[model samples]
Target: MSESRLHLHLHFHFLSLLFLSCVSPSYFSTTNPDDNSYVACGPHQAQVLTEFMNEFDSSHCNLSDPYNGVWCDNSTGAVTMLQLDDCLTGTLNPNSRLFMLHHLRYLDLSHNNFISSSLPSKFGSLNRSYPKRAHW
Candidate 1:
């Protein structure tokens, strides 16, 4: 083969190997080799619901607050639910409102530490698609 042709072939072979390495299972697999604490759940279960609940409990000591956290499957979006009770009672940070507004449904913050105020007028704008009957 000509020198240029040989170099081109070698370049293509290297490119193919690089692509295969990037797409291989060893690179994309969900199994963590370091710490096996990772739970590989489906799209619905990918949300950080349990972690948010634990954080809420740890941060504010309220066990019954029903605000859940959701992580979008295809995107890096994470939607957190901060109920009025949690917000007013100082269990959840009010600054979390920015991240909690998108992609949510059921927010139950009843009988915890709220001061009994009316719901926010813009509460309906929140995207809370997950129903209570759904499992995630």
Candidate 2:
């Protein structure tokens, strides 16, 4: 397989493992990793998330804000879930930093005012079952 395909394969594997794993409700309940004694969110993962957030006009939102949340795997230090709602304002481009989050299993961008933005085909690539829509 090509390098890109290999990368995609590994990415899919990682996401699959994350999705299959059962995490505690308390894990998702914490908005700040600092609140916990053990560091779950890796510095690099946090930086990527920060850069992704910077792509939009999220001046009103912060990492610890109630409207925005980030969950990271303690074992892998990879971001697993992101919830950014009602606080972002910008266009989501095809090459947005948001797509750099290969480890993300859950993403919520609800009630955001994104102007003239359309879901890029890459968004569909995230789900292996997404192509099944054609058969249905």
Candidate 3:
């Protein structure tokens, strides 16, 4: 598929899952960007996130089969986890799209090749911004 169409398709599928996901009563608010939006997560939200993801390099881990490498909270459509371990092989620079997932509570980038690059200082933003109950 064309890059634009592929992105749109990914967004559509992601949104479908988000909307279809079950939400708890305590997390049913749509006014905060920290949480998923009632309308859409927007292109700025999961665009790069999905673009940088693909099928795992190995098919041994079916439990983590999502080719997009993103897991969402559904009710709010906010990304909660990003497991991109051995799935992707690339360098994540300071401006990498991984930083865009502000709501992420669990991020696993282990077991992959970062090309010996250092984690960006900007990644510190995730420290304070991540909501409570963060886990990986």
Candidate 4:
């Protein structure tokens, strides 16, 4: 092969590797058992769970998960948790919220930099499905 063609092939392979590394889920950690960074609280204590999370540093800690370093209490069946605190300044992808909310019963997005315009109109559905309860 020509030298220029060989160099082009090598560049393409490198770019592909870089893209895969950034997008691969395995590159991030899942909120599963044996992953000790976070713990799963049961569903009945959703209120309490949210209260407790409010005290922590909710900034994206570079976690492997797409929730951007946020953790969850996945012990309650398949319920997931997403917390967006003041430290969050960037626009959040709507698709990410949809995916995380699929099996979630509790979400704490308080204190974030989110604007009403950035939120989806269907966001009301989240409240309907997972009604906020008093902290236990």
lDDT of the candidates, in the order given: 0.30, 0.49, 0.43, 0.37
Error of 4 at 21 (Å): 11
State which candidate, 2 or 3, has the greater TM-score.
2
The best candidate by lDDT is: 2
TM-score of each: 0.30, 0.61, 0.52, 0.39
Question: What's the C-alpha lDDT at position 119 in model 2?
Answer: 54
Tens digits of per-residue lDDT for model 1 on 1-136?
A: 4433333322332222122222222222132223432323233322333323322322333223221121222232233222322221322333333333345443434333322133334434443454442210
Deviation in Å, model 3, residue 29 alpha carbon? 20
| Steric overlap count per candidate | 3, 0, 1, 2
Off by over 4 Å in 2: 1-39, 62-68, 129-136
Candidate 1 colliding pairs:
104-127, 104-128, 105-128
Count backbone clashes in candidate 3.
Answer: 1
Give the range of the ten consecutive residues with the poorest summed lDDT in model 1.
13-22
TM-score, candidate 1, is: 0.30
lDDT of 3: 0.43
Over 3-117, each residue of candidate 3 has an lDDT whose tens digit, in order, gives 3333333333233222212222233222233454343343444554444333112222233223234555645666666544443333445775556667778665544534323
Which residue pairs come into collision in candidate 4?
A: 28-64, 29-64
Select the stronger candidate by TM-score from 1 and 2: 2
> Which is superior by TM-score, 3 or 4?
3
